[model samples]
Target: MLDPLAALRTPDDPPCDVYLTGSVFLDIIFTGLDSAPVRGTESWARGMGSSPGGVANMATALARLGLRTSLAAAFGDDKYGEYCWESLEHGEGIDLSLSRTVPGWHSPVTVSMAYEGERTMVTHGHEAPPEESAPCDPPLARACVAALRPGEGQGWIAAAARRGSRVFADVGWDETGRWDPGDLADLEHCEAFLPNAEEAMRYTRTDCPRAAARRLAEKVPLAVVTMGSEGACAVDGGSGENAEVPAVAVEALDPTGAGDVFVAGFVTGTLAGWPLADRLAFGCLTAALSVQEFGGSLSAPGWAEVAAWWQHVRSFDDQGRAALRRYAFLDALLPGPARPWPLRRAVPTIGFRRV
Candidate 1:
């Protein structure tokens, strides 16, 4: 991948641009399902792809975009874990110095069925044993991405924040059935809080997602709410900046990791100091490109995809001036002598190992 931030490199820069830690899952995606499987019936899919998922999804997305990304997670000592480890560390050029392989542990697996632009997933596996998970000592980086659950904050988040690492957080569903904002104490240390529209509304107790964004902004410096196909909105409490951008239209194959991809894009733009709207648009563009492919991490679009998409859009006569202007930042950021390929997507399945 071309280095988008090459111009900003300094002798004293951090060793990594993004540091991530979470569970890694082996994702097997089945697309083109005509319908949801009926009870007692076998459903066949037209396509299948495999890749690393969970935290690995965000890590891959960030690395593919030329971010120096480090991942800290537990990998099972199994073929599945080997495949995921190899894909992220070797194929995607992510740093796994903080990650470990757990003996006798089963790699978590998620079987995703894509149908009608949505997916149904069945996942199996146990959490990594505490002793086998990532260590408490986090690496210093420009920023870190953390998933805030509906409970006490992860101690590492506060630690990283105090260490001058910008923290960006994504929220999952409130399984406890209590959408208590106080439960997310970690947001205090986060530079941004990203939640889906439904999750935002529930957490903020607001019927409207936009209002929820405003409410969340009070808790975090930046509050972003993704509204699926409609697009996303962000409120920057610090600068009083708010921006919304429409989703780029594309036929989605699988959305398993699209949210992760979007967050990666947004973080990339934010670190680059792009305007608020550009950040949201870049994030949305990356996500739109992601779904057009298959799988999760492997389906992430690198610079190859971004340059190709930009060139293709520029060649067209009808692409609006506004659309071009909105993403004009890419014109200056794309590395010199760049060439576009159809894409740099990984194979439909994890490629076979050579002897």
Candidate 2:
């Protein structure tokens, strides 16, 4: 596969852009929690809000970074699905022509509880993966596949690759139960693969995430395994060397969708012609900033914020480094505690505990 980033500078082709394909869901979040209730008992609720999530978050992140982006995914005709589609359609600058609405399927939904800005989610609606369609425009199609499925999600990717687009793939947690090792033939054609630590460990059946990442890099041109707080490692097939990028220090509130934000940041940086090291740093920074907010996309920082953070951290002289050490000291001294949201008064409490 050709480097989509390089292809962007080609005189004959139009400016390079990204096409996002996958699931988009409505995220309902409950906030203001004091503590999790004992099993079989009712819990109180503090607050609730709904926002756009899933592929919509990824696409929105890319668009917010000033990339030309299009979303290709499935939605239902239900009101929630309509809201999902409308959110993407009205997104600052995203293209939604490729999005399809399935007549009977319900749009995906995720209910989350926020504690100290960190969220725990319960999700539904994964039986409906988007149906593969014929290539629309070859270049656009290639970029599109990168966001959809690669390897196991191969049919569409192969089609797009054959049309000459550089493809990248973001592996999701659902793959843990859904993917079969034999289904990885299509991964051979991927230009880049992004899998979080848990996903990489599960897919490769290895306890060492770096080792698993190396194994994946052996297959694709680039493979990244992100380890929260420990930072991320990127293996370049061309150099056969793995490099580590340290994570930025930040107060983590909710970790929901941090990996997705990371993928969006990495891919955006990749398309911007950033080197591997810088790309990983930017990706980690993006994710760290994401946890400080409540909703997924709503938590993602804009390009200006991302750039400023990057510059500030990179400028760390001895005093700045000392400040970082002090910050780490304070964090260690006062380990943040988890708090569950209060339950609704009308909802009956149910108690259950697992050993």
* Most accurate candidate by lDDT: 1
Q: Tens digits of per-residue lDDT for model 1 on 1-355?
A: 5776777889999999999999999888999999999999998888888888889889999998889999989999999999899888987889998888999999999999999988999999998888633457678999999999787669999999998999999988787899998898999899999999999999889999899999999999999999999999999999988899988877888888999999999999988888899999999999999998888887788877787778778766555455587788888877543334553454566667689
* Per-residue lDDT of candidate 2, residues 199-218 (tens digit): 77777888988998887887
Off by over 4 Å in 1: 132-134, 317-322, 336-355
The lowest-lDDT stretch of 10 consecutive residues in candidate 2 is 342-351
| Shift in Å, residue 136, candidate 1 | 3.4
Residue 256 CA displacement from its true place in model 1, Å? 1.5
- Computed on alpha carbons, the lDDT of every model, listed in order, comes to 0.88, 0.67
For model 2, what is the C-alpha lDDT against the true structure?
0.67
Estimate the TM-score of every prediction: 0.95, 0.77
